[model samples]
Target: MFVSDSAAVRRPRIQSRAEATILHADLDSFYASVEQRDQRWLRGKPVLVGGGVVLAASYEAKAFGVRTPMNVGQALRLCPHAVVVPPRMSAYAAASEAVFAVFHDTTPLVEGISIDEAFLDVGGLRRISGEPVEIAHRLRAEIATKVGLPISVGIAGTKFLAKVASADAKPDGLRLVEPGRELDFLHPLPVQRLWGVGKVTAAALHANGITRIGQLAELGEPHLRAILGPAAARHLFALAWARDPRRVETGRRRRSIGAQRALGRRGRAPEEIAAYLDGLTDRLGRRLRAADRSCRTVVLRLRFDDFSRATRSHTLLEATDATASIRHAARLLLDTAQPLVTERGLTLIGLSLTNLDDAGPRQLTLPLEPRAENTLDATLDDLRRRFGSTAVTRAALLKTGEGLSVPLLPD
Candidate 1:
């Protein structure tokens, strides 16, 4: 059992400037922790957070080999007594915010990989913090104290080492890769730990008598490039030797924002389908605004009940983050893809904006006919932002109307 010592006093340690100290923090059993925090009855039990698929399973559930994205039926077979709860995305989002507050307190140069995990550049704070190991320890203690959950902290010379260290320090532990020991620490690890070494890659490496990071690192760049291609091979080779040079870029603009939905066993009316389109478009537009980027193209992705997939995209004459523009463009793409949608029972729909750039004030075209008023977009955006994303919606999404009305993401 991993007992958290939140009140333990920090022991001082000496440090050096040559050491590269990156911090990786990952919350332990995040969704399960949220469940335990909200509902007292769930504590100390095997908990699974999902219905059709296992989004997350508690450590207690891990004894039965229930992992994420496994079929719920399979998970139940493994852990018959597991307490299953439908996911509460909003709760997870809130908890992620709370976790980020702690990360920001540690350093401003934080690279958020996801809502649950992030990389912190503590190199800037070394002078004030005493030692990076001490900082990692203090971070773990603070998270356990304030969030009512356990987090594992990893401090290492690079991002790859930091991530591997975090994995080694799972379930409320801290692991640090000391300076001048990068190779000694990494070489003994399995080759699977090297970035880009998926099951297939590992199998290939294993067949070549390269089962450890050291063996993979021993191969020349040309050898890896021949086996794994130029890009993946180079990345894997560098990571195998613990050589990552990427910096923690904070406050960087998002590259893209998008939304997706799954429609169960769809035998839907055209109206219902249109409603879903509107809902997805609205969600994407809001994300664009939130990220302050506008896109020149809207893509419509559809997956059939039989698991067949098709995509359609349309480029706009001008970039815009306005919901009306996005919705209109997306609908056109959806119309073009109408044959694929009706041919197979639609199972999923997704909307994405590409060719993104920082949003600027909308420009008026001089020769084109007067554009329709964009009041609806502004009004809905304002209403959603103020009251809630669901407070105001287009009439097309009414139950009686043609829209699917699947839920939308926050504005």
Candidate 2:
């Protein structure tokens, strides 16, 4: 359902000018939207992004209960006619860049949360541009006309309200949360809408017959503290009152780079799992170097047939972007988790490089580029760029089917 509530052009509601200046802009079903925009036949149809794990699902797909990160097989079972397109990371990246350019042009106080979402503080642009609501409508028009994409915008007094409002006005829509009516708009929402209220917290709240934001607010901080610990009680208690003081921060650096592969339901031999590890590390190392960053920690994440997960990490003394070093660190962590994998029956392998830093003179690079690098890794990357990703592959990955590449925002 493509719902639209254009509250961006409000009828002068009685409210303070200090409120409703924050705009949260989020691309609707980003990857899937990009696919549909480029392929005319894909529009107004259920579309799924990725072959293994569903990276994204269009609203059409969501209507059928299909969701992101769901297995493609399960998604197909739900929506049999849905178009399953292999993820085109490059296309999505280009589209994201174009959309962000529009965002930057709209306001200098833009805080990009991800490739597809941003919190734009249009607080002081009323005189020079227009009111926040008018600016938001123009911003949406520019994206739709210039980039050929549907984006939802939320106008609110604070960051959290803006985000929630955007989600409510999804699939090419706009919503504005009126000032002094924040609690009225917020209290009826499920407690899950509050930040940090994940499955566990929601379950606990539901168990105690506290499901709505109003019910949560009715409980005093001390009572909440007794139910949930002090930190959580404080956090939820504040948010339940629609009180969030976070500013739209800009120029945040990415701290980690990672990738994960779904190995299907069947268990694999140790050597097969090792091959998958090599592929994952290779992909992430290339990504880290491409981003002009190096990392000090390598983490190995595993998911089993029982749907449980285990993680092991190793922190190196020095940060490096070398594929060999990353693979070695990841392998050691994997080695430690072998017993757990065996006991649990492995179904997935994930690798993350953390504690990232800007590439310095001491930072290592691919063998052809700098000190003691793996020549094949460098050569293959070059070949892939010149030709295509599937044009070159490692001998170990011949029949293993190189996994799909997930997109990340540029530095």
Candidate 3:
């Protein structure tokens, strides 16, 4: 349904020279770049990381029309000479930590977006750190020098503009969108450049003859609402005029903790899929416990070979971080989706625990009857913490060849 809100539309408020200080730093092809950084011989060569599907592709591979999440066979067809390498999760984790350390050193106000990107607010550091551009420059230099990775940085008056600028200056570069020049820099770009303009939204806009951001902006909020619905209309309209008000938040906890794995477009037995789910549930439970969080909802996300996706979720009777409980809920959800999976071949599987809350101290139960599962969870966590993640593995994983547990950045 289309809606209109005339009063809600307005140009972005301009900031003073002092407040144009947000920086968005993003690593270039993070995973593949890390692979190249450690293996000097792979430098300047097309590298594809992952065995079944391309997890990350170096810029050289990208130049040859290879992209991440692409099938290994298709990628090789695009660049047959491309070197295929397996993902080294621990190494990537170490590189991410080193890069984030540099981010923290640059500013106390750092908001990590992912394992490879973050937003840093250097608004009040002028007296000590000079200008935001200088800070971004130094940050890039430090990351390249200290971590052996190239990072692109964007400086702007707002977080949205900063992120857009950083993306524009990709493959190792820097860009600054000044306060007054935000619209000038933004409006000429394609409508797809707008944060929320995905394929469906872009198609809608194109049907209305709105091919560029400026065209979308000139449509006015009321007209945009009539085309893109109320929420998307308001969001995209604001971005068109550079009206983002988001601040760089530090120590912010994510609403949900989740991880996913890509399976190639191939048929697999139900038992194999179940084993993968077990592994993912184990990892998620460990993460939930580590973060002192509990979730009420277990979500199972699946991608079909046809590029379609389906999600199934179940809310538990109680919010808990227990491994067995979450795994049980996840298994039920997967059972419900199995019919669909069989109808359309599964290509990817993911799990997310939502409706999160703090998992407080355990209640003292008098005459403890030894809760074996809880004790086992604690024991496994301790062993993994001390002897590494491989110290305790589920028998299912051992037989099914469950994929590697990639290290995720703290949210």
Candidate 4:
């Protein structure tokens, strides 16, 4: 529909510092950086955050190929001299809040993608905030001083290029993709740099002798469609041609709440998988309740070692926010997708709830076995709210192993 908001319209040109608009901000080696900032001994050392797994790696560690979600054993093999630290999520949360405060200070139009990254639209602030490049410079200084960590930022005409620029400007750097230079900046990059073109997609592109953004851009839409499927081919072609038009939207309602974990390798028992699902369901349910939302559709996602992923979902007759209902539905979907889990092993599992509505008003009449007793749901929620999420517990969940249900953060 190509609808445009007249109020936020920006010129299609990149001018001096006073005229730039879109800005992409990213925290550099976020988790590990936080650890280093908090502990004096860790600075300038290769730091890996996590015990059995590598949740994040410092830039020093990354140079040795230590990456997130890889097992600790693998990370150690890659960076034998790395200093490992357990994750401090509460500290990270506080740091994220401070960084976001700096972002909001820059402008009101900020879109948060995650706790560590966001896009700020400062076009409308040109008259009030001087130059965009100067603003980014100030933002970097503010973060380094106040937050005690390094951050990188990118300024560009479009969100996609801004993100690309941010990636290119890593480890406490800033890069601006000047308007009219987007193609020059994007086309020479490897095809893997394109969003959604993971290892599987890249291999498929390579099989057809397509390895660079320029190559992908040269294949006309019809040729791309014939080689890849309609949807992916069309999207890849558009991205290859540097045609991303997504705007920096703020105040957009979140459509879903979800959590996922990489399982990696094979030989996992069904019980182990069930426990993982239980932990994810608990997190999703807490997020749903805290948001005061309920959903009818429960979706389960599974990824095979071969990189094939499958998703199954089922819609309930009535909306509910109870953990039991969400987990029950998720388990059903997991069971149905079991045939896809080969002996070779699995790589990832995820859970999401959609078709959301505000938590429905309590009904007078209900089935004998409803999702939950309204009185009980209320009591538990109040306790958790007044105390902490751990104030109330499910006996079954208490049996979870350390690695099986490591709590990343409270709801």
Best by lDDT: 3
Pairs that collide in candidate 2 are 367-373
Task: Give the alpha-carbon lDDT of every model.
Answer: 0.77, 0.86, 0.87, 0.79
Q: Which parts of model 2 have CA positions greater than 4 angstroms off?
A: 1-17, 361-392
In Å, residue 233's CA in model 4 sits off its true spot by 2.7
lDDT of 4 by residue, 10-126 (tens): 324232333236889999999899999999899999999987678889999999988887889999999899998888877888898899899888899999888899999888776
lDDT tens digits by residue: candidate 1, 240-292: 75667787778765565667766667487766777888888877776677666
Candidate structures ordered by lDDT, highest first:
3, 2, 4, 1
Point out where model 1 deviates above 4 Å: 1-17, 199-211, 264-274, 301-314, 332-346, 361-364, 367-374, 394-411
**Model 4 regions more than 4 Å off:** 1-20, 261-272, 303-310, 337-349, 360-374, 399-411
The TM-score of candidate 4 is 0.85
lDDT of 2 by residue, 295-358 (tens): 9999999999999988899999778878889989988988888998888898889999999998
- My TM-score estimates for the predictions, one after another, are 0.82, 0.89, 0.93, 0.85
Clashing pairs in 1: 271-402, 271-403, 272-402, 272-403, 272-404, 275-403
**How far out, in Å, is residue 95 in model 2?**
1.2
CA displacement after TM-score superposition, residue 213 of candidate 4 (Å): 1.2
C-alpha RMSD of each candidate structure in angstroms? 8.4, 6.8, 3.2, 6.3
